[model samples]
Target: GAGVSQSPSNKVTEKGKDVELRCDPISGHTALYWYRQSLGQGLEFLIYFQGNSAPDKSGLPSDRFSAERTGGSVSTLTIQRTQQEDSAVYLCASSLASSGAQHFGDGTRLSIL
Candidate 1:
């Protein structure tokens, strides 16, 4: 992908349903990150992956949230039993290295009804 690409730019789901969001990072980038931004709230880091290392899942809100990166490239985030509080913009970003600035995608707007 040129920059980062995320699927289903807008998603509307009923409460308790599950939703999966996808992200394709830029070529050759080694670090990928997922973040969530709620209305009037700052971006919150959800997870981070660098190469074959263990993913940093420190910021996932609950047990229902999970993610995985394949081949050190594309990534997917799944939210199970979605709640109204889950409505937010999920953003994906990638960097050449963990210490570099990240390039962000437009984000997936998930709305739990």
Candidate 2:
């Protein structure tokens, strides 16, 4: 893809159900990030993987949320035991390196029923 790509533009699930969001960044990008945007709220950092270094998971809200970037390209975000509060647009971004400007995907909108 020419730009960042995300799977399942929209997802609706009952509370307690788990969901996984996928992100495919621009080829050759070495930095990948995940963020969440809630209604009327600004983007909140979730996690990021930079090269082969250990991923930074400090931004994750809880143990239920986890993300991983494989081979420095595709990334996945998993939410366990979903709750209504977890509803949000999950955005993914990538940069050439840790300090480079990021390119973002359209995002995956998750709804909890």
- RMSD for all candidates, in order, please: 1.0, 1.0
Weakest 10 consecutive residues of candidate 2 by summed lDDT = 93-102
lDDT of 1 by residue, 2-112 (tens): 889999899999999999999999999999999999977789999999999999999999999999998889999999999999999999999988457899999999998
Query: How many clashes would you count in candidate 1?
Result: 0
How displaced is residue 69 in candidate 1, in Å?
Answer: 0.6
Clashing pairs in 1: none
User: Which candidate achieves the best lDDT against the true structure?
Assistant: 1
- How many clashes in each candidate? 0, 0
The residue ranges of model 2 lying beyond 4 angstroms of the native Cα positions read none
> What is the C-alpha lDDT profile of model 2 across 1-113, one tens digit per residue?
79999998999999999999999999989999999999767899999899999999989999999988777789999999999999999999999984669999999999999
